[model samples]
Target: MTSETYPVDATNRVKRRHDRGRYDHATVHALLDAAALCHVAYVVDGQPYCTPTLFWREGTHLYWHGSSASRMLRNQSDGQPACLTVTHLDSLVLARCGFNHSADYRSVMAFGRARLVEEPGETARALTMMVDRFFPGRTATLRPSTGQEIKATAVVVMEIERASAKIRAKGVADDEEDYALPIYAERLPMRTLIGAPEPCPRLAGDVARPENLAAYREGRALEDALADAYRTAYP
Candidate 1:
């Protein structure tokens, strides 16, 4: 992390379309922090498995939670090699030829060893951090988790040993002959938008929305809201 870029090896090097690969920490960490979900791939008994879960980043580390009995968590309880990946689809590239069509996206792949957080205090803090990652300072307004609840939950942390970001945010990339054809070709932009908030009907009438949710307003882009949450939570 002291260096601007991570050391690239066979494990983290982007082989295909190497030009699209980014080895800098800024690009990789930005993509990881902006997304709320990630797919963690690990091998258990020589079988490969990829589990999708909500994840958050703290500097060079990534954390996620799941059921204590989860196979993925149990297998990763001890130090085990894992790959965490996050992606954001930016647009749909429509090319005249099917072979040339591809969606534009920003993605990061992080390689590391994952281990369960067994310490009670650290587990509580990690869970709280996960919640506050999307809603900054919201955990303070919530009640503490009971011992039984903590026992049933599992928190895993991975120190990012190496990471690389791959981005393709440009318009359509079609062959020269295909572009001149009559068929239409363009990039259809896409985005995740935040919908208006809905309160529970059983809630007390006097209860008002918390200040932490100010960034999650209607018509806001999901990525932008998350970015705001990250800034507020870290700052």
Candidate 2:
């Protein structure tokens, strides 16, 4: 079956080279779930602020958390408008001409109004969801959060109103004349690789890492593990 899609408005539409824009829900959510860090922008007291925080995606909603006293969390939890973005730099496009140089990336921009999740129970669950989504099958393996710990943190969930994703995975593109020049041109691919899991010196007995983490090891493909998270069982 075909994937569902989201609407694009003047605010979220990728107009400037619109050909790169995609409104499909799969594309949008994939970009969000592939990365845990998202930069959320909001206006507080007529001044704009963008804060990079760990984020989680579920269905069409995005969630983030921070200290209860954080200004970004405070402002956003009060129903302030927010624009959240996640990006992945896939490669460096080495074009024959400097003017044609561009990076290959996957990115998504989502517009929404943030809502504070006040109920302690729900906030706690959301935190668990974030952990499960990122670390995957690891939440139950560790110690659970305490009541006091939950109370000191704040969580905000944004129901996406409009979202769009842009992806560029092409090889070097240079002007016809520039391509004729004897200049090096190619796409240097990149991925975030992980090193062997280091154990704490004071650690106890045997430690078992998650299976998904194996894909992130050095010489392995990190994208596969990340993409798997984006397609997790939770919606």
Q: Pick the candidate with the highest TM-score.
A: 1
TM-score of 2: 0.90
RMSD (Å) of each candidate, 1 decimal: 1.1, 2.5
**Deviation in angstroms for 61 in model 1?**
0.4
Q: Model 1 lDDT vs. the true structure?
A: 0.90
- Compose the digit string of candidate 1's lDDT tens values, residues 82-192: 999999999999998999899999999999999999897898788888798889888888888788987898999999999999999778888887767999888999999
Which segments of model 2 are wrong by more than 4 Å? 1-3, 210-216, 230-235
What are the lDDT scores of the predictions, listed in order? Answer: 0.90, 0.81
Clashing pairs in 1: none
Off by over 4 Å in 1: none
- Model 2 score (lDDT): 0.81
